[model samples]
Target: MFDYYNLEPVLMWIHSTMCGLMPEWLAFTIEGIAVGIFIMVMYAVLAIILIYMERKVCAAFQCRIGPDRVGGRGGLLQVPADVIKILTKEIISLKNSDKFLYALAPFLVIMASILTFSCLPWNKGGEILHMNIGIFFVLAASSIGVLGILLAGWSSNSKYTLIGAVRSGAMIISYELSIGLSVLTMVILCGTMDIQEIVAYQENGWNIFKGHLPALMAFVIYLIAGNAEANRAPFDLAEAEQELTAGYHTEYSGMHFGFFYLAEYLNLFITAGIAVTLFLGGWMPLHIAGLEGFNTIMDYIPGVIWFVGKTFFVVFLLMWIRWTFPRLRIDQVLILEWKYLMPLSLLVLVIMTVMKVFGLVF
Candidate 1:
């Protein structure tokens, strides 16, 4: 028999041993700090891999080879080289900019990006905090990034930055309504906001499959809303470079700009993680509920692979949309939210609620 719960104490003991010579409280503190650091490091590694994946995907779509000259076949080390160049570049501050906020903004956004990962249930018995309100916590942490963008724009003291900040604010707020409504619909059906519990609910079948028509429609609405929330095209009104220069961080230079850039990619992962947990079922293997052979095959795979595989699929779709579509104007973005997404989500929520009341879905 495979013993899973038995491994927890062993892992804890190893964690405790790694923080040796420290007081018990200090050991816990160190462990927490280590976990946080590990998350950051993982984000960086994933971002690098995603960058290469995105580059290759975009190249194929455009009929070109992306980054083929750096380190070996596909320039595997290209990301590190890019990082080095950014790290070595000059850091410049504008004469009239607010130094404090300008310097603080990038890290604030980066922190928000990392914080959202804390509540994500990556696998069975996995999560940093394991909170019941994990879904709400993730949403709250993600919203903090908009504030950082606002700070960066105002601190830069540039017209373009101000416009970018304003655009991001309006766009995020509009899209968030639909996103929240869709997520709440899931919470209503699952009867708990705990991510692990949500995952459990999807073990037999994904929510997108279980809830049938209503859940599928909500899933589509969620994806559209999430894309806008992540500032991805055709929803990238925030960084409309052709129109607003470099957008909110117009005056930021070197590593500061790099921070903003990295945070965008990190946000993509975080949003996809949320999507997996809510719709596709985080760490849950796929099964048609009547097929033992298929279920057995899925069970053979580790939980982490299922979780990461679904997340990357979502990310890949987002990249395809980014490369294939034209960017929408700010007004059109608002029209998309106020006119289409919000109404559809509201109607879908009502339909889902009615279906559950009638015992139409499990």
Candidate 2:
């Protein structure tokens, strides 16, 4: 059954057939473009789904009906309608703005988000780019999106935008250290940077259990820093609605604003995906020692199903945190990073390193 869902073999067969019909380079380019388009469409669809899920989740917590009008029972069409409305709206531009940079910012943000997908292992043999430095590539690609935020703010020529950008820059710089350190802790435990290899290493059990306390601490810090990286509350000082009136994106309108909106949700998914890949075991199934029957039952389930389930579980956790906590002040956000998470993450990394040296990790 899992073999039927293995897309890599199918795609490879298609590529081979295409190569027979045309030049290998041309066939490969066409295949690549097709895959890229599929990913972009998936990203857009996922963003819509996340937006709807968030609204419903927030409404449930607040004792409200959420979206009841569109798409019948639950207003499932709300996001699609909103997308249409945003696309149809006129793009407003201010005089004396850096037109090129202002126009380029949103694409840059979306591009950075999309690029990270290449390194993400969707299932066994399903990564777009199987690079040796998979985890490092993800971190590097993700950090580039901040530049788009900065450009949007600076190019707008608004004081509010400038302030938001500065706050975001400072927040990212502070929190990114913790994120890196936490990820390094996992890398140290796994002894490999290849995302697939890390997942395979967890065939016996997840690192969250195998690596024990150090892995748990790294996961906690990762979640905190990941939320901050995505600019989600209570770390959303970069886009404090009451404070900056939309923050770095205050001057953006129509599709420009939509791009930022889509990028934010995509980044949320990326963070969750990383968490799932690194700590939760990616597509690996649950297996208990001396429980062959149960393990066999788990193996019957498809890898993609397990991967998506774990990723969305983490996504829901992030959403719960977002709605439960109020936005933090810029100073407090920085303090949480530099004063607490950063030092704690560093310590966890050192502990994991020592444990690895001593052969304490399972």
Candidate 3:
């Protein structure tokens, strides 16, 4: 069994040590910069890993050998090579394009993703920002990345890009309702917005089991809405390659396009992480009502391990769905959200609220 450990205290110690060597304000600034850089590096590494995983996964589904030539085994270096290629490629500048917004768009998308990471509880007492309104902060912050997508599409001075951007804006706005309602259902049951508190509430049992049907419904709805929000296949109308020729980022190349790609994978991870945190009990170990010994054994495992394991499980589910499903048409995407998911989400929320009032949860 792995003993529990947390990185927060170690980071705080480093911050304090730096404070002793510099002015207080300077130390604070330096700490912020360091944290930001750490997040960026982490994001880059995870993107590389996810890209490689996605390629291998898709290739497996298609029964083809994937990237065997790039690295020693299974082409592990393929992502790094792709990154170097992108970095070295020439970024075309369109004369008719809005220069400033076009350049700023990718950064905006990346920034939104980075900001969302701050409030996520990686383990017990391992969050960067423990705000009372953590759930709301996450929902609000994650939505801002859509603005970057819109900007990229609009500033590209291409009809294809503009159409893709419009489709993305409409799809995201529609799906977010279902996403918000699903999250709200969890909040109603937990009666708290703090991410850590919600997780702690599930120490004895996961919310999915506690809330039963409503919780399961919310989880399903969240997964669907989240996939759409991340613009994954079936909901990737905004970047339908066959129709829009790579959609909103069609005009982008080199590192600019790389940023959009990185943001997409990061957003996928964020969506999966939120699902794990809310429905799967965050870092809490599996604890059955009568199995104390088993629960105790689970407790000995590090919380971070449980958290990451649950998160990646959800990520794998999303990937599986992506490879299995066909892309939905733009009209079908809106219809799924507005006609089906939205109404069902609202109904689930009501059911959960009533259950909470009557003390009916498990």
Candidate 4:
């Protein structure tokens, strides 16, 4: 019987087969190109899905029909149409803008998103680049987008963009601490930074149920900080449409603007992916103690399905928050981070560390 649960062996078989016919170096080169293409294709497909999902979700929340007249039922083709429109639209440039930086800014944001996306452990043996410090690598790559945002605003020479970029910088400086602390808390509990190992650590039970209160606290803190870092509402002060008029990318048009838009959604995916891996067990299926039959049935399902299902659930939670809550004022945003989230995160970190020290974590 073909076991869908483990794909690592299948991948190895394919690579071995290729090496038997082609030069070893050429085989590796082809494999790299293939993986690159897979990442790009997955990136575009997910972005399109998220764009449509958000519109429909927002419409539902507001009690309005969304994309009813676009293409198919429920505006199924609306996002694809928008994609075509962006591809064909002329990229408008400001005459006084720093040409080099302005052109480079959008690419920077998109590239950073792609780099972080590569770090996800998609499924069993499905990781593109599973490194020892995968979670930290993701954090570092995600931070690179901050530079892109700042450059987009500053290079454009627009006051509105500058203000938006400044707010983004302040927000990053504040929320990033909580995010790091929360991740560190998990690292202490899990005793490893490799995402795959973290998943393995949850083989008995997920960290949320295993570590109990502190793990739950870390999860909440990570979600809030992740939302803020991704600049999603209600933490979307960086591009408060009513006030800053599109924020850092105010002067961007067409596909340049599209890059920023897509990056926002993909960044959300990366955030949710990490959260799923660290707290929700990544590709590990649910396994309750003393439930042998139930566990066996769960094991029959593919790891990819588990990973994708858990990830989308988290994504929906983030999306729901975006449509339900109002955007925060800049001061409120800062106060929430510094006064509430940071302190809570620090406390959670300490508690988790104590749990690890005392062997209290299950």
Q: Whole-model lDDT, candidate 4?
A: 0.90
Return the lDDT, model 2, position 198: 89
- Estimate, for each residue in 1-362, the C-alpha lDDT of model 1 and write its tens digit: 11232235666777778667777888777787888888878888888888888889889889998988899987999988998899999999888778999899998998888888677777777677678898988888888999999999899999999999999999998888998999998887787999889988887789888788889898889888889988888888788879998889888889999989888888888888888999998888887768879877778777778889999999988888889989999899999899999999999999999988888886
Superior candidate under TM-score, 1 versus 2: 2
Q: Which 10 residues in a row give candidate 2 its minimum summed lDDT?
A: 1-10
- The positional error of residue 75 in candidate 3, measured at the CA in angstroms, is 1.4
Per residue, candidate 2 scores C-alpha lDDT tens digits across 1-362 of 24645667877898889999999999989988998888988888989998998899889889998998998998989999999999999999889999999999999999999999667778877888787789998999988899999999999999999999999989988888998999999999999999989888888899999899999999999999999999999988888988899999999999999999999998999999999999999988888899989988888888888888898899999999999999988888877888888889989989999999999999
Candidate 3 local lDDT, 1-362, one digit each (tens): 22256566777798789888999999988877887788778788989988998998889888987888887977988899999999999988888889999999999998888888777778877787789899999999988999999999999999999999999999999898999999999999899999989998887789999999999999999999999999999788899999999999999999999989998998998999899989999988888778879878888888888988998899899999999999999889888999999999999999999999999997
For each candidate, give its TM-score against the true structure: 0.95, 0.97, 0.95, 0.97
lDDT at residue 166 of model 3 (Cα atoms) = 96
Q: What is the lDDT of residue 15 in candidate 1?
A: 73
Global CA lDDT computed for model 1? 0.86
Task: For candidate 2, list the clashing residue pairs, or say none.
Answer: none
Q: Candidate 2: lDDT over CA atoms?
A: 0.90
Pairs with steric clashes in candidate 3: none
